[model samples]
Target chain A: MPIIVNLDVMMAKRKISSNELADIVGITAANLSVLKTGKAKAIRFSTLDKICEALDCQPGDILEWQNPAEKT
Target chain B: MWNKHRSLKLSRILVLCFSVMIFMMTFFVPFVADWYEDVSDGMGLIGGSVYVPMMVTLYVCEGLAVWAVAELHILLKNISKGEVFIERNTRCLRCISWACLLAGGVFGVMALWRFLLFLPAFFAVMFGLIMRVLKNVFEQAVEIKSENDFTI
Candidate 1:
């Protein structure tokens, strides 16, 4: 839970819908939803590569780490 | 191919027949003797030849179902972790496995009941133990699904 996916935030900043990203990344909308919601345990390198390429951003921009106890 | 489907269909029919035999045992075996108080008059007549063949066939069919379910679980786990991608999955297969487990348990209990009736209580406990194993596996399937949204 400490490793958070900031995909939705990044998607909003870049003005991309989850569906559209799913299309660009060649994955299903549901999977994209998982990543967006931070429910995914891990992301495949191939998918991560595609996502970064599609969004024109680095992986660091999409993934943020926070200690659970430090949550606001 | 149609031929492949035909062979699969035949095997399915055979499995169904075996299931029917088990069903017969569950229903009729009870009337023949109470599940427990009949306990040890050497009950539940599954005769040697019929018993061996039924056990073999059930073993094979159930083995296939178990293997498929296990593979499906693994695929689901991978999908959850994003290590795999799927176009679709076997919802039918999962449903069939659950049905098989329940049905198999019931028939086994009915057939064995006369031993405890001739032998019922301890037999039920044995069946309970088997049920627990099947339940755990089913739960693993469920965990894989919940983690994978059952079908995402």
Candidate 2:
């Protein structure tokens, strides 16, 4: 839960839609939605690799660890 | 070759038949107790004396038996639908286990008065333990399945 997915930010910066990114990464849009919404427990490295390859970004650019208590 | 579906269907039918048999026995309790006294002349007094306790014991056990069987039927229905390891099935198993324990407890108290009740009391305790174990297994499985589902 502390691991946050910034996928939507990256997608917006890259001007890519969820459906398009999902197609390029060979995953369903529902899974992309799960990743974007931070509802996924853990993302597979292969899927991460595909997402980075499609978005032209590093994993660090798409993922962040922010402690809720430290947000202030 | 017999399959799991067929086996479950058979179990459902068997439970239905047992429920019917229990229902019939409820109506025949008084007659059966009277006949039991008549069958053994020397033990007639003992039979007559135990009649009320016997009826109470049988009715209570039979009521629990109906409840347990209904729980089993629902559990089997869910399993046949490929819904094993769910919380509902675990709940059904829990209900069946408690029913067995309560029925066993009834017979156990009756055993204090008549030693003949010990046999059923022991059987119910063992059955309840088995069902409790099964419920625990199902609860664990459901937990694991949810964790797996969330790991995207």
Candidate 3:
């Protein structure tokens, strides 16, 4: 889990609700919650594409890599 | 007629019937002894005193087989309910394998006393080993299934 999902931060930056983003991205809100909470083991490229298109952002904006030993 | 459910049901029924037969036979030990005395007198296979020891060995092995069949009943019920590759089934298989091994060991020891018991002892131990292998497979399958479930 060195890779982190910054979905919440990006969603906040764009001022979009979870339900609205899920609808626009054509995924269930529960799956969106799993992604947001970093419970998903993988993200398909198609799903990532839909998410990026819906949020008007790049994949890099929503994902980040941080060393567990480093304090953010 | 050839469906998995039907096949499983048939297997369950057969196991249940065999269990019941063993249960009934345990009660007929004295009669079996009399019959054996009559039949084996010509062949001189076993003497009258040996029947008691044979009865004891048979009863102990039957007890183990009965317990194993009960485990099979639980396993079949779970499979029928669509609960394959679970820990409970794995435990059931382990119990059955141990029961078979114990029964086989008892019969094998009895064979030292009576040479006629060798065949059953050999088959029982072989079946037990097979069951042990099956239990290992189920254990691996359960691990893979749990990992798959958690992947999402």
Candidate 4:
């Protein structure tokens, strides 16, 4: 996890709830939660495509990479 | 028709039957030994002189057999429940493999007194090796499965 998911931040900026985003993204709320909480190991391109279309944002807006050593 | 579920059920029943047979054999060890001696024409390897040591070896092997059988039962139970690649099944396989190896070792020692005992000792060791391989396979499968599950 140095690669972080900023899904919640993007969702908040877009004024979209998890349930609503999940509905538009054609995924379950549980999966959306997993993506939002950064627990997902990897994201499918198709899922990312749907999420970006739903949130009107790029993949880069929802994903970030930070150095673990720098965090400490 | 043969099927996976029925096959598993049969394997479970066979394990249960083997356990019961082993339990019953515990009570009949002395008589069975006597009968074996008689059938073998009082072979110097199994008769009165070597009876005590023979009984000791047999009991040790019986203990290992029981341990192996119990582990097998649990392994089968887990497989029946669709939990094949879990950690518990790998532990069960490891235990069963060790039990087989220990029983083989016991038999190998007894084989010093009787050459014929070496056959079972060889088979047991081979069986143990197969189980050990299977345990390794399961460990890898469980790791892969965990990675796959978390990939979403």
Candidate 5:
């Protein structure tokens, strides 16, 4: 529960549209939105590699571990 | 052409109709004295507690067969419409339909095998038919599924 997808924040800082990111990352806009908003149950490493390469960020920049998090 | 699809549906309806008719015939026929006890003799239920339960079970099995046919019709139509692009869903439905028919045929054959002298060869044949129809249903469903998956 504490792990977070910081895709939206990173996208905002990078001035990138979800659609643009999806185009570069080779996935559907809907699936991209699923990953961005943290609704996805799990991420494939291949997808993760594509996303990280497209965003030019470390995996930690996209994923954050937070304390005081309730268990899902 | 009037069509095999329509014929199969008609046959399913007829099976249900005949089951009810047989129950009524067993009920009204005067040679049969007791309602629950004697009906088994006519239906070939033997000395066990199978008479009333068998009649009741025919109704239930036929009811389920009707529902299964309806669902198979929908799945067939789905395959026709290109709606069932997902191979997983299509495959599962095909497997289920096959399973239903397999069980139906096994039970039907068992029924005839048990009551060979008393019951006619018709139920055995009907069960054979259910198996055949279900096989066709599965094949057609899979055919369209493969075609559509390739298209997609």
Candidate 6:
């Protein structure tokens, strides 16, 4: 939960729609949605590779880690 | 041909049959007790004196047996529907295990009056222990399944 997915931000910056990104990433729209909404528990390296290749970005660009204690 | 579906169906049917048999035995307790008394008369067992207590114990055990069988029916239904490793099945197993243990406790107390009753009490406790272990396994499986489902 501390690891946040910034997939939607990266997707918006790249001017790609969710369906188009899902098509290029070879994953279902629901799973893409799960990633975009930060509901996924973990991401596979293969899936991360596909997403980075599709979005022309690094894994760090789509993932962020924020300390839970910092929120308080 | 025999398959998983047929096996589950058979298990459900057996649970149903056991339920019905226990239901019918509820009404036949007095007659059965009288017959038992007659048979035990020559064996030096406590005959007519323990009739009322024996009937009460038998009814209680039957009620617990019905509870356990009904939980088993639901569990089998869930498995037949491809819903194994879910929380509901664990709950059903827990209920069935508790029912078995409670019936065992009842039987154990009755065994003080009739030593032969200890056999059934021992078997019931053993069954309950097995179910409890199964429930623990299911709980762990359900947790892992949930983690896996959300891992995507």
Which candidate achieves the best lDDT against the true structure? 6
Candidate 1, residues B1-152: lDDT per residue as tens digits?
57854655565566566655655654443343333233334445553223333344344435545554454455445544554323233343344445455545544544542333323334434544565565556566656756655222
- Candidate 5 is scored at a TM of 0.46
lDDT tens readout by residue for model 6, B27-73 = 99998877765565332244436577678888898888888888888
Models ranked on DockQ: 6, 2, 4, 3, 1, 5
lDDT of 3 by residue, B1-152 (tens): 49997899899999989988998998897787666545542322443455666677778887888899899999999999999989999999999999988988887776665566777888989999999999999999998887665342
Cα RMSD for candidate 2?
3.5
- The CA lDDT at B113 in model 4 is 65
Q: How many residue pairs clash (N, CA or C atoms closer than 3 angstroms) in each of the candidate models, in the order given?
A: 17, 0, 0, 0, 0, 0
The lDDT of each candidate is: 0.59, 0.84, 0.84, 0.85, 0.60, 0.86
Query: What digit string (tens of lDDT, one per residue) describes model 4 on residues B31-124?
Result: 7666655564322244344456668887888899899999999999999989988999999999999998988899888776666778889999
Query: A4, model 6: CA deviation in Å?
Result: 2.1
In candidate 4, the residue pairs with backbone N, CA or C atoms under 3 Å apart (3 or more residues apart, or in different chains) clash, namely: none
DockQ of 6: 0.68
Question: What TM-score, over all chains together, does every model reach?
Answer: 0.48, 0.83, 0.72, 0.84, 0.46, 0.88
Candidate 4 CAPRI level = medium
| Residue ranges of candidate 3 with Cα displaced over 4 Å | A1-72, B33-48
* Off by more than 4 A, model 6: B38-48
Those runs of model 5 whose alpha carbons end farther than 4 Å from true positions after fitting are A1-3, A65-72, B1-55, B79-152
Clashes of 3: 0
Give the interface-residue alpha carbon RMSD of model 4.
Answer: 1.5
The positional error of residue B71 in candidate 3, measured at the CA in angstroms, is 1.0
Candidate 3: lDDT of A72? 61
Error of 5 at A25 (Å): 2.6
Worst 10 residues of 2 chain A by lDDT: A34-43
- Candidate 4 overall lDDT versus native: 0.85
For all predictions, the C-alpha RMSD in Å is 10.7, 3.5, 4.5, 3.1, 9.4, 2.8
Model 6's C-alpha root-mean-square deviation from the true structure amounts to 2.8
